[model samples]
Target: MHVYADPFWLPKQGNTEEEYEDACCPRKVTERASCSFRCAVADGATETSFSGLWAGLLVQAFGSGRLTSKRRQETLRSLQGRWLSQVSAHPLPWFAEEKARCGAFSSLLGLELGEASICGGGRWWRACAVGDSCLVQMRGDAILSSFPIRDSRAFNNRPLLLSSNPGRNKEATTMWTSRGGTWESEDAFYLMTDALACWFLTEAEKGQQPWRRLRDPQTGDGTFAELIAELRRNGRMRNDDVTLLRVTVD
Candidate 1:
């Protein structure tokens, strides 16, 4: 099977792009090709300190398979140590230090796709999520599956998140939910951060296929920026760091 993946993202309306806190692994865009791959996205909570760094590390750890069930807690502790080390290297104000002590928080979603001979020689994908970040599978014009958080109303400002402070995150491993399924040649999968995810679900609830808009080949950074600009202009979508990753199985 050929796999193609691309990501489009934009910062909140008033924020500079540098201020965008969401992060994704396999950061480079992917063209249609035959290969097995893993990817992940993390949205850092704005109220936390060094959240972007925490988010980036989480995705990289997950995408590299370092965050496995057996090593989940151990890996998280290592990552937390790394975060603290990085933070200590830079000078921080008193308030920043206070926030650092409290820890950074971020929502995470991880995905792995490969050819599965066990399933009668078909392509299959497995996904794990900690919060509102979502994965939706589509076959042609219909959405076949929605994981972790299915309903639009289910999304709120607060979501269970992974913390950079391991001491306060005893349930980190248990809080994640995972699902796996097979996919056909033409199936498409989307991983989205909270803002765009909420809008995607709301549109789906209205019996609309928002994926069509996202899957268009012409959709790129500029396209996404314009669409998000209009959505914010019309007040249809919340103004937040928006990210969307599309993976097509062919």
Candidate 2:
């Protein structure tokens, strides 16, 4: 059995051609000899205050690499607590100051595919956010799951959750863990931030999964490159920084 992993990050248009305000990394863990894990952190802009810093810090904490549901919450709490301390010292006058030059939110997605299970967490959001990062599962021609962003009725882009304030009410970032299931050798995982995700899923529904298009047996040159060029040519996804990753399990 083999696994394939690919990650890409792009900035929004007109912003130095960098669509990502956060940093993402995946490392191997020894605790699980048969499985691999990946962690991603998407930092919000600096003008948003300490969001990016907070998101980055949380990813750093998971360096220990043994993630459970409890640990995920703990990691987020620690992130929040750290942010609160920093803010207490600096006292941000406005929320925008905490973000980077652009309004970005730390949307995180990770996967740990063990011999017996697959565990993951969706992106970050506050109480009022209307959307969320999607976690898509692919098995050949079928789409298994597309976890959409879930939020309370009041969510309206307020400062959601940050790693700096550990003691505050932890915003419930979504997590999925399956212990007993059958994942064929052809199963694949796709994680994407908002804009690119919407584009990909919409295309998938229209019988055009971007990855499938790129992997088409009959493509000439490179379909992925062509797709990128087409996107840039048509301004289809020039609004936000785009980050996309695909991993295949076998």
Candidate 3:
């Protein structure tokens, strides 16, 4: 199978792009070619301190295969220790320090995909997630699977998240969900942050093929910016850091 993946993102209106806190690994913009790989996206919680850094670490750990179910707690504790070390390097104001002591939080979605002989020689994908970031599997124009969060209404402001504080995040150790499936040539999968995910599902509920628009080659930086601007203006999509990672199997 021939595999291609790309990632696109835009920060909320009026915010500098650097202010965008979401992070991904095997990043959308990566140029490497590989038949088997791990990828992930993390959405940092705006209310938490150093959340972007926490999100980045989470994705990197998962993509590197160091954060599996058996190693979950150990890895998380290691991550927390590293984050604390990083925080200690910089001086923080009183309030920022207070928040830092409380730790950061983020939503995570991870995927592992490969051409496998086990599933009768087809391409297979496995996904794990905590929170609202979504993975959608499609064959042709129809959606074959939606994982972690399924319904459009499930895309609420509050989603269960992974935290940088291992002691405070019991749910991350136990509540993550995983799913696996096989795909044929021409199958497609999408991993999206909450806002764009909500829009995708809403459009699907209305019988619209949102993937066609998403998969278009013209959906680059400028086009995505325009589309997101219009969607936010029309109140169709929430104004947040939006991200989409598309993986196609051919």
Top candidate (TM-score) = 1
Candidate 2 residue lDDT tens string, 31-105: 223444444434354345455555556445543453345676666555565655565665445644543223223
lDDT of 1 by residue, 1-250 (tens): 5778788888888999889999987777976454567888899998887888999999999988988677887898899999999998988999989889999999999998888653346678889899889999999988888988899999998787899987656574578899999888888889999989889999999998898889988898888899899888999899999888888877
For model 3, residues 11-93, the per-residue Cα lDDT tens digits are 88889988898888766565444567788888998888898899999999999987788898788889989888998798899
Evaluate all candidate structures by whole-model CA lDDT and list the values in order: 0.87, 0.49, 0.86
Worst 10 residues of 2 by lDDT: 122-131
Best by lDDT: 1
**lDDT-sorted candidate list, best first:** 1, 3, 2
Q: How many backbone overlaps does candidate 2 show?
A: 37
Q: Which has the better TM-score: candidate 1, or candidate 2? A: 1
- Cα error, candidate 3, residue 175 (Å): 2.2
lDDT of 2: 0.49
